[model samples]
Target: MWQNKFETRLELEPRPSRYLLIYQIVLHTLAGAALLLPLILPAGVAFVLLATAGGSLLWQVWRHYREGRGTTRLIWRTDGAWDYQIGVQYWPDLSLLPSTYITRGLIILHLQPVKGRRLYRVLLPDSLPKEQWHLLWLRLRYAGFSEEDVGVKG
Candidate 1:
């Protein structure tokens, strides 16, 4: 769309990650088992307390996951600014930190504002179609490696 423009902004819309879903299921199942482990271990107040603690933790994680933590739509500008949409909320104008990690199999975007908690979005291999993923990966790598980011330096 911006073939005539100097700088290109990127928008990557990846479908929900099945790998992430699987990971979440397995991880939570293991945690739930751990929470129930006390039942099989023995009968004691301490064991019950331990199980309760684990259950509480599991509940918190599950709640967080259910509340808009899966699948992201990311928009990155050439000026090191970015935004993302999680679930139905669009988080805008977050600064993209240089700490972002990009690799062949995965990509992690480190997004944060001037005063707020840091946020991260992880992109797995299956996040997008093969060709799209390849192109996106190339663009990310290129952007990260570019010194000036824009052609004309001010």
Candidate 2:
């Protein structure tokens, strides 16, 4: 017999995905190759291209590290509305989308916000204890999210 009641709050510390790391490596490698093109072109033109690529790579790395450093909190209320906080952003009155996206090591929750773009929160099960992850998964399903959306690996 499973209890219908669930914990009111859950705090998840997400980890960076290895796949994302690999993708970043590939992206930087391609950028590095592009940066070498300045050797064959005019010095001024090549400098601009090199600067642009270098800046883009630095920005991507900074964003990735920042995103992976915070704890995400989910707070559910009896009235059926939920609040999600990640880093400094707060989302209230969120509804779970009907589908969930699960991958090799990640479970993504697609949330519908009351007045903005849909939000996707990624969870790394490997970073959490199995029991805790299972509990969170149960609570999500209990809240009306479906597991039928589990095929895409993004």
Candidate 3:
């Protein structure tokens, strides 16, 4: 779960349908190294890189925790009264042809604060199960976005 707003007493938690645990483990391990490796480096340079990676990792962890705790959601909430959200499912050969792999379907979300316009995008990867993709879409839409509000161009 995740939320964009810190106030208003609202929290959103959205678990990764897949890769959730693996992602957490990898991120935590890298963060741990970043925090620990600086002790061996030459102080000046090591400290910088360590600080950058470790700090980022720590923050990511905090975000993940907050999301899990229903304190935040993945939806981008802007102070400008604008919000936008999108999800993408990478294909098996995403590394080979990054752009054209979503030949079957794509999913996206777009919003225009000034224009009050919302968009939806759905792009299906050949590798993804059609039923799972639909379920994911349904979940996303129920989280406060319209099916037509998300787009896939970007």
Relative to the true structure, candidate 3 has a C-alpha RMSD (angstroms) of: 13.6
**Cα error of candidate 1 at position 97, Å:** 1.4
What do the candidate models score in CA lDDT, each in turn? 0.66, 0.66, 0.39
What tens-digit string does per-residue lDDT give for candidate 2 at 97-140?
65666554667777788789988876766556677677666665
Sorted by lDDT (best first), the order is 1, 2, 3
| CA deviation > 4 Å runs, candidate 1 | 1-6, 29-41, 44-72, 145-154
Q: Write the per-residue lDDT of candidate 3 for residues 15-82, one digit (tens) a residue.
A: 43224435666876776676665375677776677677667767766755654444213333332132
Query: C-alpha displacement of 55 in model 1, angstroms?
Result: 5.7
Once superposed on the true structure, which residue ranges of model 2 sit more than 4 Å away at CA? 1-9, 15-19, 34-51, 68-70, 76-81, 125-130, 137-154
- Per-residue CA lDDT of model 1 for 34-66, tens digit only, reads 656545455576467666666766775575466
| TM-score, one value per model | 0.60, 0.60, 0.36
Question: Looking at model 2, which ten-residue stretch has the lowest summed lDDT?
Answer: 1-10
Error of 2 at 39 (Å): 12
Q: What's the candidate order when arranged by decreasing TM-score?
A: 1, 2, 3
